[model samples]
Target chain A: MRLFISFILCVISIAKVQADSFVVDKVYHPYVLPNEQEFEWRLFSRQTDEGNKLAQHIAYGFALSERVMFEAYILGERNENDSDDYGLKSYEAEVRWMLTEQGELWADWGALFELEKQHDSNDWEATAALLFEKEIGKTSLTMNFFMVYEWGDNSRESMKNEFRLQYRYRFLPQLQPAIELYTGHNYLGIGPAFMGIQRFDRQKQLKWEMGFIVGFNGNNKDNALRVAIEYEF
Target chain B: MFKWKVNITSCLLLFSCAVFAQRPEFVLEIKDHLFYPAEIHIPKNKKVKLVIYNYDATPEEFDSFDLNREKVIFPHRKSIIFIGPLPEGRYSFFGEYHPNTAKGVVIVDDTTTVNQPLEESSHVD
Candidate 1:
């Protein structure tokens, strides 16, 4: 309850700021492991509403400013009798800053810093990426090539980097489906994938996404599926 | 016979004007999270008028890397851009905010993509 009240107060305060002062021009990026279709604050709600607490994965989020969005998800030992998973899984938070409104030569974009912890690990690993995107008509395309770093007693200082390219279409202002391709060297292992999302009210929403992660060389391929609802006070 | 001759002359004039009036136009339509008629190709050095129409209540933008253009397209409204005598290459565009939902392409080259090529395609999405 306290968390909810704080979020509402934060929103009310941020509302006083002008849209031009920050780079948060749009919202959502439609794909999973990628981005959902970005809609503006005015269109945050449309097809569906973010569901109840049980329906949501063990997580919490705060939209501090238009340009900054933050989230944390947990995954510990699953207790069949318990309603919520209290285990601390990997931690991740992102901030999408608008660098510019200028043309392609100086493309304005969003970048994120994400951290993850292994199931039984103590130290946290991180992924740093830069997303340069543009909007054409009702379509938005983004090119992201980020590096994943490992941190541990036995881990290297800087581990590896990967590249991703994605394209999304907003068929309806609210219903957006997306396609994505990714690889280690931008082509190490290529895969085809998609995701869908909807938010019916201001900060309240629900989103669903699926991913077909294809691997390269001797690596195995796998499919990831996720469904969740979120509510903001 | 006189009536038939007059009708034929008028029809011919209309046809000629229609063919001559054909102007190249490009539109990126967002439907079901994908741009209908995803790919468009136009010849280089042609006077072209491009308009993007977003029917959804959410606003979208037409962005391209090859052509060096970016314009915000509001919901239920139209965004317009003009290109003249340009180079040849593949120029891709998409909605900046919704990269996951909207996308399309524009291929500018010496060749054209529509049949009966009428200078370029005056009708496209």
Candidate 2:
């Protein structure tokens, strides 16, 4: 009986730290397609005074209806402790619902719900975000406010909040330059981002984005580099 | 001097006529994130107005890279958009939020029939 009780305690303790261990995937857009499918891959790397972290993610996305879209992502990560060892980290799913059309009001709006399950640990997290977009001529801005709650046998009982912002200048149909900012508890980052799209035909297209952020506040990394590529058919 | 006066008057009248002419209009409806009449036919070489009504409780973005136009239609609301005196061809559009299901096309051709759904003609007699 004592051995079983100790085993239970161990499991609960592992679950707690796992809930808060995942990396943040911060780039987002306010548009949703009515009937489209996509396969996307993203690479995120961070360098701090303490250590370096790298994460890889693959996702499949499809429109559920005219205003709703769904996506699933498989994530892997490598940290200083793991060195070159990178393996399955977590599985995440999300639903995005567009709330307003572009130019229909002062700003466009959308909402997102996400759930993440960590591998080999009894840990999970749920997140919700409100997304906003606005455009004036060649300039556009987007913002996302996120609320995350983690739960499990050992998870913290507090809610975590985050905010991300991006501003872009459309220089051409396929290329744009942007600035991004992120803020969270004890975390602040600002960076320059560049993105472009290539349409191969009426039905196929490719998009790429790259960003470099410098941490500006406490307990945050000094810099991080993020990149994402998506293919739609 | 008499010929010049006649020419000036004709030009003024033509300008007024063009200014007063109204473009044809069509109604597109969105429900459950799908565009009604997935295919639309309109007269070629004429500007037209599109009145889109969204019946869903969520917003969707109407995007058409081919037409170089995009608009967000709020749920339970209506939006108006204008398209050009385009050449005969097919212009495809989709909901950016629900791209997989909200797909459609606008077919502009000279042979578009009068019986098709279109706004009242604004041609000057």
Candidate 3:
């Protein structure tokens, strides 16, 4: 446990050295059940020196097979300062692949791929990510390493990377408390998150999550709030 | 780019086919929201298929924290899940919708014979 904590601190230190773009989003897990289907909505709001920003996503996803799932999302954003700028921002398609059976390996493994296009412009972005999860007793640790490439007429072609980590303690079937960390080019944030699920008959369940994050970059007063709800059937 | 896409697609198809190939099969039945047999014995360290038939008018989700498996069996329908290749131990599972009455355990042991049918118990407490 000491070694694990040291490793986490080392990673966080490295991440903070060059961190920049703050991303407030839900952490993805590495499990995919066969024939599972879900509809999800996510809201993220951030307050920074520039202004306040809000983004929303609605997505529908289904498993293609035991190990693979596909999802599509409609994304919208509003600049609180610019009242008229609220509208659709982008469309995204994502694929998640479960690489290892849940306890078959020392740690579970998965991957994610995403392609996004701007609603009214030629801007596009593509991302590939590796997902890892390890369970120690009732606590679970998950991490994501992402590589992104952006290109198009409206944006400069560039490549970027991001890392996210979540450590969760499972106290009950319906509730779990977690600590999450996210790092990117110009931002580093850590926060507390809570998630729960309510199961219903006929293969239906509702899952909800919320988190509040504060930026750690020097002289930057940034805060973000994110929430998500998912219904699976 | 096109060639890369083709290669990835082909690899995924091959992997999917390999995963769906032959494996040891077992059946569990859910009636009146209770799991039949109450306990099942299987060989340890081997992947196996579990086909659950739900006879209740309402659906039930087979949930297990120990085995890390969760699946919903629809009313009057069957659902399939693959479990194990795990170490020898007792893994408990319960019906999410009827947690009070629908419960069972999977006993993974080397000495125990696999798939020995047991009389279905009428009640679980």
Winner by DockQ = 3
Better of 1 and 3 by DockQ: 3
lDDT of 3 by residue, A16-49 (tens): 5644455668789988876789999999999989
Could you tell which candidate, 1 or 3, scores higher by lDDT?
Answer: 3
Assess chain B of each prediction and give its TM-score: 0.64, 0.74, 0.73
Q: Docking category for candidate 2? A: incorrect
* Clashing residue pair totals per candidate (backbone < 3 A): 48, 23, 7
Looking at model 3, the pairs that clash are A19-A185, A19-A186, A19-A187, A20-A185, A20-A186, A20-A187, A21-A186
Assess the local accuracy of residue A112 in candidate 3 as a C-alpha lDDT between 0 and 100: 97
TM-score winner:
3
Minimum summed lDDT over a 10-residue window in model 1 chain A is located at A18-27
- Candidate 1 or 3, higher TM-score? 3
Can you write out model 2's per-residue Cα lDDT over A1-233, one digit (the tens) per residue? 69945843453333333333333356566667666789999998878776888899999999898679899999998886567678898899999998865444557799999998988788888999889876654567887877789887666666776667788887755888999876665456678998888866434679888888887655655688999999987
Q: Which TM-score value belongs to model 2?
A: 0.64
Worst 10 residues of 1 chain B by lDDT: B115-124
How much is the lDDT of residue A23 in candidate 3?
A: 61
